[model samples]
Target: MLIDMSVTPLSADDRQRYARHLALAEIGEAGQQRLAASSALIIGAGGLGSPAALYLAAAGVGRIGLVDYDSVEASNLQRQVLFTHDDIGAGKAEVARARLLALNPRLAVDAHAVRLGPSNALDIFRRYDVVLDGTDRLAVRYLVNDACVLAGKPLVSCAIHRFEGQAMTYIPGRGPCYRCLHPLAGDALVPSCAEAGVLGVLPGVMGTLQATEAMKVLLGVGEPLLGRLLVYDALAMSFQQFSFQRRANCAVCGDNPTITRLEDDGEATMIEEWTPEELAQQLEGARAGSLLLVDVREPHEWAAGRVPGSVHIPLGTLAARATEIPPDRTPVFICAVGGRSMAACRYFAGGGRPAINLAGGVTGWSAVHGPLPRPEGCQS
Candidate 1:
């Protein structure tokens, strides 16, 4: 698909604005022109989308769409850098659109403050050339992927944990879908940014990569991440790429195509909440050996009075140490306040492992079980 860059001559403003891009050998005038004609829809306005949107707007993408149902919270400021304390309590998509437009008034930014689900995904995505999945939930990730496949649009997906991140691009026939790599969501608890905690700069790295891939696809300049997965370890400061093949039996994009329609995963809804009383019951069950409790909190948190006999495996380590979890027992996950455990539960449940959430988490556990005992040399 050779782009006719000469058709749309750069305006004086664009030439001055993208002077740096015109200087690059790989992305000269033609690439910049292509970018100016591209349209992209980003699905999250939080951490990943924040950077991705910012970079894309600055790069002169012609049209950008933002979708998010959440409101900015004080907690989101840690990594959702696009929002400010003043923006807290405001809709994420609304705030993001205002900010991006202020940064580049020439670009078109459409902000939709509604949740993107199967009902609206196709209609919302059909308007854009590429869809970027910045959402952190497993079910939503699958929804975005399948929708992209069904819409025949490309998807640039990225996920982040505490110190690690992963990214891949799905170009329908040209590459493998997300299911091809993670065929089954593994039993290991997938830590979330909220539960496992993330360095403020981590999403900046991964989200920027998502933005880069989107721009590359738009400009048709570099090889997109088709059929490849990029994994990054901040602690080790290393990046690795692996080849992934599409699964012939994939339920959605597979040869048989059994899933012609979208079905919401009920487990995703169950993992999102935990009442105080429910949390207490789960903790009691853990104490009596009625349930196998898995603590995916930090080591220091465990040392500071974890449920007795509960095994500690920080969420970041859960993926690499899946064998450590005993398959004979029904696992119940616990995090500081339940968010991370929910993410972990979703990953496990999606992988065919039935796990329960320890509502209220350890914070609630300590309240009912009495103040947690502070381990020696451990700061409470």
Candidate 2:
């Protein structure tokens, strides 16, 4: 067993409560007892944490810690299955604690109704055998992974975006850490679920997989996702596995590692921004001829509606079509929201071109000027 089986002997009630687990040959009495002795710390009591918490609690995990500072909102009812209409406006961690206790009164649930920061992450992580990273924020993801490496604890990290999601496991000295796989300095340029959108049932599927991996890690019964990434697509209803390797120069878990302490990952470099009102004022001023309005949204979005004098340069094709942009005029990038445009701005700025991002993209512009003008043949 992964954990010490010398834990308190299972009572008649535990045997009855986990009768199903006890029946499985892989997770018989000893495995169930191991589960009963193990503890898990789950960050973010939102969509991913909801199902994982429920299953781990019902499966007899002795202790579970939930970390989140936000309160439940009405929109959370769609994917955050741990809360209900009555739970709206309630603290997420506390509500999740109550729900887990109600599911299984034997286990202990710790509700950390505060944000997880570098100062407190290591201390909180040391108490748990494993960590489940359910947070959607990019910086927090790196913090959890790095802290686990420093604390020598196993981490089960999962992320969902739109219709797809990915899960991976990291064990100290066994495999690559999150930084080894994603060497990028920051991931904030990637839009969040709210900035984009997600299928209501997506996190449910991924979080359950997270619970499955956590139990396996506790039981030491099956091969964990160590060195492997599991990607799931709800639209295609398929799963794919990609293998990764430990980097020799990885900053967190490498032979000559540089990062020996916990710190927040640096955010994307700040670029110049222009509000919709500023763009309008510039269009009517003498500098109107000196600006090149570049719409970096997808072709579909561009076809629907766009600014009158803007040029369509999809983000995916922008890098290759750099020559198309005029050298004399300043380029102002715009997208559906600001994320893709920000990325475009950074790209041009890296090439020594002074670029600007529309603060809120087409949505912001439309909000200011009533509605954007559409193409003659556009369907939307």
Off by over 4 Å in 2: 1-5, 186-195, 264-380
| Candidate 2 backbone collisions, by pair | none
Clashing pairs in 1: none
Q: Which lDDT values do the candidates have, in the order given? A: 0.79, 0.84
Q: Pick the candidate with the highest lDDT.
A: 2
Instruction: Compute the lDDT of residue 162 as modeled in candidate 2.
Output: 84
lDDT of 2: 0.84
Error of 2 at 144 (Å): 0.7
| Each candidate's clash count | 0, 0
Look at candidate 1 and tell me the lDDT of residue 122.
Answer: 87
- The candidate that achieves the highest TM-score relative to the unseen native structure: 1
Give a tens-digit lDDT track for model 2, residues 1-380: 13555688889999899899999999998888888889999999988999999999999999999999878877688999999999988999999999999999989999999777777899999889999999875546877888999999999999998899999999888899888998644443443323557898999999999999999988887999999999999999999999999999988898887778774332222245778899999889998898899998877788879987899888777888988998998888888767678777767765767787887688878877878888667754
Runs in model 1 with CA error above 4 Å? 1-8, 185-194, 264-380
